[model samples]
Target: MNKKAIWAIIGLMSAAVIGVVVLQMDLIRTAVKVNEERFEKNVFAALNTVVRRLEAEENREVFQHSINGFVTAYYEEHDNTGEGKPEFTLDYSGEDGRPMLSPKLSHSSLLDELMAEFANPCTCSQCMARKDNTYRSLMVYFQQNTREFPLEQRIKLQHINGVLKQELGNRGIDTDFNYGVFSREKKSFIIVDGHYVVEDAQPKEILPGYRNIYNSRYKVDLFPEDMPSPGLLMIHFPARTSFVWRSLWLNFLGSIFFTTIILFSFAYTIHVIFRQKKLSEMKTDFIN
Candidate 1:
């Protein structure tokens, strides 16, 4: 082939290969993204399943009604201040008892112990102290509109934590996660702080020297659509930037290998074309 034809062929081949590589890369990225999203949803689904069971648990209502009865009675009795909190709620201290304050009961009070077993539990980054009443009680305000049941039952903590631990163990999913239940009607106030990280089955750590992308936040509504949602459930899963990087490295190496072959072939073709042109020139000079 002549030089011009050789160049044209190289151009066309490079363009085709580039197009295919770009398309393939795009497809690969899209596939990874979809899988990541699905994986997150599955995690949420598993957690949600646990929560639903807890919510529907027969004893759950038993506990909620108990809290309701306790708080309602306290509110009715303590409403000497015409504008105290209409709803019965337990907050960190008398501080949370603002204008709408209800009866402030200590965690260890006889009534609190007899009824809700309120105790100020120790607080931590990973978990809330249910005993200390740090967990707010918003059940009284949006009682009708909310789909939430009381999380004041201390036993429910183990149940909730157990679900997460069970799922991590069963699925063999290596992920560090923290989950929280938030009330939308209550201005996104947390109904149950489910931020416990299962220590034994911690998620695979991000590979060193790789960016940590495990800070992704995902929220899935607890209540079903067309139904009133008292709150939402949110989970944070550490991103697998290391795993993603491994895949990217392979892709980069593959692209380099492929492009190297095409470039070598194109160079050889050009060399041949130039040699042929030189041979033709020699023949013409001999005839002249």
Candidate 2:
């Protein structure tokens, strides 16, 4: 090929290599962005799961308390009356202040009466009103008795750690994490990892390495229905960025390897073209 043709081939090869490099960079960038978003999504989901589990635990306790109260009231009425048949009144006082039943029965009879009264009911106004009154009173009782303990007493650091680790691991994220429960009422962190931050104390100053715990990207409300103000659960992963990038290392290395090979081939091809051109000129001179 002539000099012009040889230079044209070199320019085209250079442009191809540059384009390949740009494309590879863009692909890596896009991959990193996608991985970051996936990581965030998983973390948020895990936080929500933790919050829900905590709420369920509290609800279970409240329900158990309500059942015990109901059973105790039944026995008390029976003992006071000193009769085989006792009148039981379920007076769950709330805003409505409506009386559900004043039945003359025994414990077993009461259960049967309750079933007969509430279950297999027709669409009558009286039955519907009774159902609505019963539901509202129970809800009021639950709301009134829920979360009687303080935030610190209700939540344990070990439980939080265990649940968070399990939930995050379930979502394929296992990393060293720092978590804190910030009490909105106290306006400070009640607990952070292994230590408890006192009211009005600076968490950053108290826990040097756990500075990010308060400003964590992953956060959810703890006991949202807690009176006055609800607490916040915040989690920060120190090694999250490294962990996310680790997954893309192989792709990055492979791209680099292939790109290197392409450049090497291009260089060798140019070198061979120049060498042939030099040899052709020498042969022409010798022939002249």
RMSD of each: 15.6, 5.0
lDDT of 2 by residue, 27-101 (tens): 999999999999999999999999888776766567566655775787677678885435554543545656454
Model 2 error, position 14 (Å): 1.4
Give TM-scores for every candidate, taking all chains together and pairing residue i with residue i. Answer: 0.47, 0.76
User: What lDDT score is found at residue 211 in candidate 1?
Assistant: 19
lDDT of 1 by residue, 104-189 (tens): 54323423542453343535632343432332343333344233443232225666677767865565456665555544443432
Best model per TM-score: 2
Point out where model 2 deviates above 4 Å. 70-140, 194-207, 226-229
User: What stretches of model 1 exceed 4 Å from their correct place?
Assistant: 56-155, 168-172, 184-217, 223-228, 240-256, 263-288
Which window of 10 residues has the lowest lDDT sum in candidate 2? 200-209
